[model samples]
Target: MPSRFTDEREITGVADLTPVQRDQLRAAGKLYDGEDLDAAARLVDDPDDERSFLGFCNLWRVVDGSEDRYDAWLYQVDSGTIFRAGTTDVAAEIIQFGLETRDPAVRAELGPALVEAGLLPKSDVSYPEFAGLLRTQQGA
Candidate 1:
Protein backbone atom coordinates (compact mmCIF):
# COMPACT_ATOMS: atom_id res chain seq x y z
CA MET A 1 0.00 0.00 0.00
CA PRO A 2 1.11 3.55 -0.60
CA SER A 3 2.10 5.62 2.40
CA ARG A 4 -0.66 7.85 3.68
CA PHE A 5 2.08 10.16 4.87
CA THR A 6 3.15 11.41 1.50
CA ASP A 7 5.30 14.44 2.36
CA GLU A 8 8.86 13.14 2.20
CA ARG A 9 10.88 15.86 3.85
CA GLU A 10 14.22 15.02 5.37
CA ILE A 11 14.40 15.74 9.10
CA THR A 12 17.98 15.68 10.26
CA GLY A 13 17.71 15.82 14.07
CA VAL A 14 15.90 17.18 17.11
CA ALA A 15 17.39 20.62 16.50
CA ASP A 16 15.00 21.09 13.61
CA LEU A 17 11.96 20.92 15.94
CA THR A 18 10.49 23.61 18.11
CA PRO A 19 11.08 23.34 21.83
CA VAL A 20 7.49 22.35 22.49
CA GLN A 21 7.59 19.60 19.88
CA ARG A 22 10.77 18.34 21.43
CA ASP A 23 9.19 18.45 24.87
CA GLN A 24 6.11 16.52 23.76
CA LEU A 25 8.24 13.73 22.33
CA ARG A 26 10.41 13.77 25.44
CA ALA A 27 7.44 13.63 27.80
CA ALA A 28 6.10 10.72 25.81
CA GLY A 29 9.50 9.02 26.37
CA LYS A 30 10.04 8.96 22.64
CA LEU A 31 13.09 10.20 20.81
CA TYR A 32 13.07 12.34 17.73
CA ASP A 33 13.94 10.57 14.48
CA GLY A 34 13.03 10.73 10.82
CA GLU A 35 9.77 8.87 11.34
CA ASP A 36 9.00 10.72 14.56
CA LEU A 37 9.79 13.99 12.82
CA ASP A 38 7.49 13.02 9.98
CA ALA A 39 4.77 12.06 12.41
CA ALA A 40 5.25 15.27 14.38
CA ALA A 41 5.16 17.38 11.26
CA ARG A 42 1.99 15.68 10.15
CA LEU A 43 0.35 15.47 13.58
CA VAL A 44 1.81 17.94 16.10
CA ASP A 45 3.81 21.02 15.13
CA ASP A 46 3.35 23.61 17.85
CA PRO A 47 4.85 24.16 21.27
CA ASP A 48 2.94 22.82 24.29
CA ASP A 49 0.46 21.29 21.88
CA GLU A 50 -1.62 18.43 23.24
CA ARG A 51 -3.14 16.74 20.28
CA SER A 52 -3.62 13.05 21.01
CA PHE A 53 -4.13 12.25 17.39
CA LEU A 54 -0.38 12.34 16.85
CA GLY A 55 -0.26 9.06 18.71
CA PHE A 56 -2.32 7.46 16.00
CA CYS A 57 -0.06 8.91 13.30
CA ASN A 58 2.97 7.53 15.06
CA LEU A 59 1.20 4.22 15.57
CA TRP A 60 0.38 4.04 11.88
CA ARG A 61 4.02 4.66 10.94
CA VAL A 62 5.57 2.08 13.24
CA VAL A 63 3.01 -0.72 13.19
CA ASP A 64 4.75 -2.51 10.33
CA GLY A 65 8.37 -1.50 10.87
CA SER A 66 9.65 -1.83 14.42
CA GLU A 67 8.18 -3.28 17.57
CA ASP A 68 9.93 -0.70 19.72
CA ARG A 69 8.52 2.07 17.56
CA TYR A 70 5.09 0.47 17.80
CA ASP A 71 5.40 0.21 21.57
CA ALA A 72 6.30 3.87 21.86
CA TRP A 73 3.22 4.95 19.99
CA LEU A 74 1.10 2.43 21.88
CA TYR A 75 2.34 4.02 25.08
CA GLN A 76 1.34 7.42 23.75
CA VAL A 77 -2.11 6.07 22.91
CA ASP A 78 -2.51 4.45 26.32
CA SER A 79 -1.33 7.68 27.93
CA GLY A 80 -4.60 9.20 26.79
CA THR A 81 -2.95 12.47 25.89
CA ILE A 82 -4.37 12.50 22.37
CA PHE A 83 -8.08 12.21 21.69
CA ARG A 84 -9.23 10.72 18.35
CA ALA A 85 -12.86 10.17 17.31
CA GLY A 86 -15.87 11.33 15.34
CA THR A 87 -13.71 12.25 12.35
CA THR A 88 -13.72 10.36 9.09
CA ASP A 89 -9.99 10.83 8.55
CA VAL A 90 -9.10 9.51 12.00
CA ALA A 91 -11.49 6.60 11.75
CA ALA A 92 -10.29 5.73 8.29
CA GLU A 93 -6.65 5.87 9.32
CA ILE A 94 -7.32 3.55 12.23
CA ILE A 95 -9.11 1.10 9.98
CA GLN A 96 -6.39 1.23 7.34
CA PHE A 97 -3.68 0.75 9.93
CA GLY A 98 -5.45 -2.18 11.52
CA LEU A 99 -5.96 -3.81 8.15
CA GLU A 100 -2.35 -3.27 7.10
CA THR A 101 -0.84 -4.61 10.31
CA ARG A 102 -3.27 -7.53 10.66
CA ASP A 103 -2.28 -7.55 14.28
CA PRO A 104 -5.14 -8.60 16.53
CA ALA A 105 -4.13 -6.10 19.19
CA VAL A 106 -4.19 -3.21 16.73
CA ARG A 107 -7.45 -4.41 15.25
CA ALA A 108 -9.01 -4.71 18.72
CA GLU A 109 -7.91 -1.18 19.53
CA LEU A 110 -9.51 0.18 16.37
CA GLY A 111 -12.58 -2.11 16.23
CA PRO A 112 -14.76 -0.01 18.49
CA ALA A 113 -14.04 3.09 16.44
CA LEU A 114 -15.00 1.29 13.23
CA VAL A 115 -18.23 0.04 14.80
CA GLU A 116 -19.01 3.42 16.30
CA ALA A 117 -18.49 5.05 12.93
CA GLY A 118 -21.02 2.60 11.42
CA LEU A 119 -18.32 1.22 9.16
CA LEU A 120 -18.59 -2.18 10.79
CA PRO A 121 -21.47 -4.03 12.35
CA LYS A 122 -21.89 -4.01 16.09
CA SER A 123 -21.22 -7.66 16.68
CA ASP A 124 -18.67 -9.77 18.47
CA VAL A 125 -16.55 -10.76 15.55
CA SER A 126 -13.04 -12.18 15.71
CA TYR A 127 -10.16 -10.00 14.64
CA PRO A 128 -9.89 -11.59 11.22
CA GLU A 129 -13.61 -11.26 10.70
CA PHE A 130 -13.48 -7.65 11.73
CA ALA A 131 -10.63 -7.06 9.31
CA GLY A 132 -12.54 -8.85 6.55
CA LEU A 133 -15.54 -6.68 7.20
CA LEU A 134 -13.38 -3.59 6.92
CA ARG A 135 -11.83 -4.89 3.72
CA THR A 136 -15.27 -5.45 2.25
CA GLN A 137 -16.30 -1.98 3.33
CA GLN A 138 -13.24 -0.60 1.56
CA GLY A 139 -14.25 -2.54 -1.58
CA ALA A 140 -11.01 -4.50 -1.49
Candidate 2:
Protein backbone atom coordinates (compact mmCIF):
# COMPACT_ATOMS: atom_id res chain seq x y z
CA MET A 1 0.00 0.00 0.00
CA PRO A 2 1.07 3.57 -0.61
CA SER A 3 2.30 5.63 2.30
CA ARG A 4 -0.20 8.18 3.69
CA PHE A 5 2.29 10.72 4.87
CA THR A 6 4.65 12.31 2.34
CA ASP A 7 7.77 11.07 4.16
CA GLU A 8 6.89 7.62 2.85
CA ARG A 9 8.21 5.96 5.98
CA GLU A 10 6.15 3.68 8.11
CA ILE A 11 4.86 4.88 11.40
CA THR A 12 2.68 1.84 11.47
CA GLY A 13 1.27 -0.66 9.05
CA VAL A 14 -2.14 0.23 7.62
CA ALA A 15 -3.62 -2.82 9.29
CA ASP A 16 -2.21 -1.68 12.60
CA LEU A 17 -3.05 1.99 12.11
CA THR A 18 -5.19 3.57 14.76
CA PRO A 19 -8.70 4.73 14.01
CA VAL A 20 -7.15 8.16 14.19
CA GLN A 21 -5.10 7.50 11.09
CA ARG A 22 -8.01 6.23 9.09
CA ASP A 23 -10.10 9.25 10.02
CA GLN A 24 -7.28 11.65 9.36
CA LEU A 25 -6.89 10.47 5.81
CA ARG A 26 -10.59 10.79 5.25
CA ALA A 27 -10.81 14.22 6.85
CA ALA A 28 -7.81 15.40 4.89
CA GLY A 29 -9.60 14.41 1.74
CA LYS A 30 -12.79 16.10 2.91
CA LEU A 31 -11.21 19.33 4.12
CA TYR A 32 -11.40 21.23 0.85
CA ASP A 33 -14.82 19.90 0.10
CA GLY A 34 -16.11 21.62 3.24
CA GLU A 35 -17.01 18.36 4.92
CA ASP A 36 -14.97 18.90 8.05
CA LEU A 37 -17.42 17.19 10.43
CA ASP A 38 -15.26 14.11 10.72
CA ALA A 39 -12.16 16.22 11.01
CA ALA A 40 -13.77 18.25 13.75
CA ALA A 41 -14.82 15.06 15.50
CA ARG A 42 -11.29 13.74 15.42
CA LEU A 43 -10.08 16.96 16.97
CA VAL A 44 -12.42 16.54 19.93
CA ASP A 45 -11.08 13.04 20.51
CA ASP A 46 -7.49 14.25 20.37
CA PRO A 47 -6.78 17.94 20.60
CA ASP A 48 -3.10 17.43 19.96
CA ASP A 49 -3.66 15.63 16.70
CA GLU A 50 -6.58 17.92 15.95
CA ARG A 51 -4.34 20.94 16.32
CA SER A 52 -1.83 19.52 13.85
CA PHE A 53 -4.64 18.56 11.55
CA LEU A 54 -6.12 22.05 11.80
CA GLY A 55 -2.82 23.56 10.72
CA PHE A 56 -2.81 21.27 7.70
CA CYS A 57 -6.43 22.15 7.13
CA ASN A 58 -5.63 25.83 7.28
CA LEU A 59 -2.80 25.34 4.85
CA TRP A 60 -5.12 23.46 2.58
CA ARG A 61 -7.59 26.34 2.78
CA VAL A 62 -4.90 28.79 1.78
CA VAL A 63 -3.69 26.61 -1.07
CA ASP A 64 -7.26 26.09 -2.15
CA GLY A 65 -8.02 29.84 -2.18
CA SER A 66 -9.85 30.41 1.07
CA GLU A 67 -7.53 33.13 2.30
CA ASP A 68 -10.03 35.24 4.19
CA ARG A 69 -11.24 32.40 6.37
CA TYR A 70 -7.73 31.14 6.84
CA ASP A 71 -6.58 34.48 8.17
CA ALA A 72 -9.53 34.68 10.48
CA TRP A 73 -9.02 31.17 11.85
CA LEU A 74 -5.33 31.81 12.37
CA TYR A 75 -6.06 33.75 15.49
CA GLN A 76 -8.41 31.12 16.84
CA VAL A 77 -5.84 28.33 16.82
CA ASP A 78 -4.41 27.70 20.26
CA SER A 79 -0.72 28.31 20.82
CA GLY A 80 -0.26 24.73 21.94
CA THR A 81 -2.04 23.49 18.85
CA ILE A 82 0.02 25.66 16.51
CA PHE A 83 3.14 24.31 18.12
CA ARG A 84 1.84 20.79 17.72
CA ALA A 85 1.29 21.36 13.99
CA GLY A 86 4.69 23.00 13.69
CA THR A 87 3.98 24.51 10.30
CA THR A 88 6.31 27.23 9.10
CA ASP A 89 3.30 29.48 8.70
CA VAL A 90 2.10 28.53 12.17
CA ALA A 91 5.57 29.21 13.55
CA ALA A 92 5.75 32.48 11.70
CA GLU A 93 2.36 33.47 13.01
CA ILE A 94 3.40 32.62 16.55
CA ILE A 95 6.61 34.52 16.13
CA GLN A 96 4.71 37.46 14.80
CA PHE A 97 2.21 37.30 17.64
CA GLY A 98 5.03 37.18 20.17
CA LEU A 99 6.89 40.02 18.51
CA GLU A 100 3.86 42.26 18.62
CA THR A 101 3.41 41.58 22.32
CA ARG A 102 7.01 40.72 23.34
CA ASP A 103 6.17 37.27 24.68
CA PRO A 104 9.17 35.02 25.18
CA ALA A 105 7.10 31.95 25.86
CA VAL A 106 5.54 32.07 22.41
CA ARG A 107 8.89 31.99 20.70
CA ALA A 108 10.20 29.37 23.10
CA GLU A 109 7.19 27.15 22.62
CA LEU A 110 7.11 27.58 18.85
CA GLY A 111 10.66 26.32 18.43
CA PRO A 112 10.17 22.88 19.87
CA ALA A 113 6.75 22.65 18.32
CA LEU A 114 8.22 23.23 14.89
CA VAL A 115 10.73 20.50 15.48
CA GLU A 116 8.12 18.09 16.79
CA ALA A 117 5.78 18.80 13.88
CA GLY A 118 8.62 18.32 11.39
CA LEU A 119 8.11 21.89 10.18
CA LEU A 120 11.68 22.81 10.97
CA PRO A 121 14.79 20.75 10.38
CA LYS A 122 16.05 21.45 13.89
CA SER A 123 15.17 22.96 17.25
CA ASP A 124 17.00 26.12 16.27
CA VAL A 125 13.72 27.98 15.91
CA SER A 126 13.83 28.26 19.71
CA TYR A 127 14.19 32.02 19.52
CA PRO A 128 13.10 32.78 16.00
CA GLU A 129 11.57 36.19 15.57
CA PHE A 130 9.12 37.02 12.84
CA ALA A 131 9.55 40.10 10.76
CA GLY A 132 6.68 42.35 9.71
CA LEU A 133 6.19 40.14 6.68
CA LEU A 134 3.35 38.08 8.06
CA ARG A 135 1.62 41.16 9.39
CA THR A 136 1.86 42.91 6.09
CA GLN A 137 0.59 39.84 4.30
CA GLN A 138 -2.28 39.55 6.72
CA GLY A 139 -3.00 43.25 6.29
CA ALA A 140 -2.99 43.67 10.05
All candidates' TM-scores? Answer: 0.25, 0.22
What's model 2's lDDT at 110? 35
Candidate 2 local lDDT, residue 48: 61
Residue range 44-95, candidate 1, lDDT tens digits: 5554555323433332222222221122222332221111221111211222
Cα lDDT tens digits, model 2, 29-106, are 343234545433433335465333433222212111322111111222321122112121222243222212244654
Checking candidate 2 for backbone clashes, the offending pairs are: none
Model 1 residue runs over 4 Å out of place are 1-3, 8-10, 30-134
lDDT of 2 at 74: 24
Q: What lDDT does the true structure give each of the candidates?
A: 0.34, 0.30
Root-mean-square deviation (CA) per prediction: 13.1, 15.0
Q: How well does candidate 1 match the true structure in TM-score terms?
A: 0.25
Q: What is the lDDT of candidate 2?
A: 0.30
